[model samples]
Target: NTFFQISDLEKKLEVEKEKTAEVSGDDDQEDKVSMVTLSGQEMSFESRGELEKAIKEMTSVVSKAVAAKEFRKADDTQKDVDALIKLREKLPSVFELEKQLKVMKQDMDKAIKAKKFALAEELHDDVEKLEMRLKTERALQPPPPKDLAGRDTHSVKSVPVVATVASAASVRSAATTPAKQPVLPKQPLEVSGPSSDKTVKHLRPSRPLSATEDESILSITQMLATKRGNAALLVGPTGGLAGILTDTDVTRRVVAKDIDPATTSVNEVMTPNPTCVTMGDSALDALSTMVE
Candidate 1:
């Protein structure tokens, strides 16, 4: 009986050794393959099958582009890749907002169960505010127009402009300023509340102007007055959103400097790289952006 038990124990030890050997082999094979990233760092793909698949796809595409001598095709692919990366980066903010909203709702429910009506009301209001923000976040920006076959689409990236918090007086000035003589084009302004449809983009009251930066401040002032808008979207020579000229800008920067509006250029006084919300953002998001 003792000899039989010893044989069984030896057999079990041999099986354990085989399993460890197999695992080590897998580790050795995983360490053999690595990828050099754009940041000049070496990344191992031992367990990332998706990354390996993406690399294979990229390699195949490069070979095809080289064979066809179609460099523009490669450029277009790069643009698509960049867009995907940007979209991926944006998704986390929405998810985080949703998580917070869920927590708020849970707290509100607890308050109601405990007969704390006032606390429940406050939590409910907070939840509604976060919900609006989440709606705005979910609104995706309209994709850029597709590039022409052989032409790379160059996009204009807005530079961060220096902005100051507007005081109560500045806000009042903006509220009172009217676009002067000729009426400017007006965009739709939709303000949604708890009772209305929540899917609509909260378009704030503003006007888009194609006037050059060298445009007279007087003309901009009149345009704002004419359109009943306190702010004008200044367009660059390239027809892109160059800057925002507002009543606050005029009051603090131009009027305070004692510069004649007729002689001064709008570009010289306008706030460059103004904060803006996309079409899908809610009214709360717009308000938060302006406040920030």
Candidate 2:
């Protein structure tokens, strides 16, 4: 009977030991899995490093696409860059969590070396919890701002260049229309000229030219010289007057500012939303508006 009782006690102890070992093994496995998972997902939140690399790669691709005249691919790549920017903005900063994790790991190592098994185990659990928390924060960060392209918008520091280009093209088309089409009035009326007494409509219309907002100031100046005109009308998408680029504008806004007209755009110096007079208005009235 005594031997049987001793055998039963030994069997119970063995079973308990196996259970403890199984739990410890499971914890160890979980820790390994957590670390592996975090590393795999590092690219998603390690944005500063990853984003720079991605932008550089994509910029090269964009340049190539543009060179190939594959505009669609270039535009698509720009959208991808915008998306990456949003993703970066949406992720919480991991700097603090990372610092805590590093310190905790160091402490855990020290505890183990000092034979403080209980403290080490506790620290290990804390580290796992911290890792889980870090993951959650990254995954559940607030949505990116409404204006994802705000940075790009700010960089250009003006109206939409594409729309401005289209408007400019329309002005060019109007300028080059056939003789049968109703001609637009000449710009920068010469008040001292013989035609000054005539109403705007009675004055003979000439081949009025235009310049795009994006056109370099030097190029537009050359165009004016080539056409022997003092001014070019800046038209909008609807063919309505958006602004005017004149020799005076170049002299004042460009030359006075010491701006590099070769690198500067007409848009930067042209008078925006210029005042206008009706066809019935006398040349004097038009000149007065110009003076104002």
Task: Return the TM-score for each candidate structure.
Answer: 0.32, 0.31
- Please list the residue runs of candidate 1 whose C-alpha ends up more than 4 Å from where it truly belongs after superposition: 1-210
Q: How do the residues 85-128 of candidate 1 rate in per-residue lDDT, one tens digit apiece?
A: 22322233333466688889999999999999999999988788
Best by TM-score: 1
lDDT of 2 by residue, 91-193 (tens): 3234446667899999999999999999999999999978886776555432223232453355354335544655665577577774624433432232225
lDDT (CA) for every model shown? 0.55, 0.60
Task: Return the lDDT, model 2, position 201.
Answer: 56
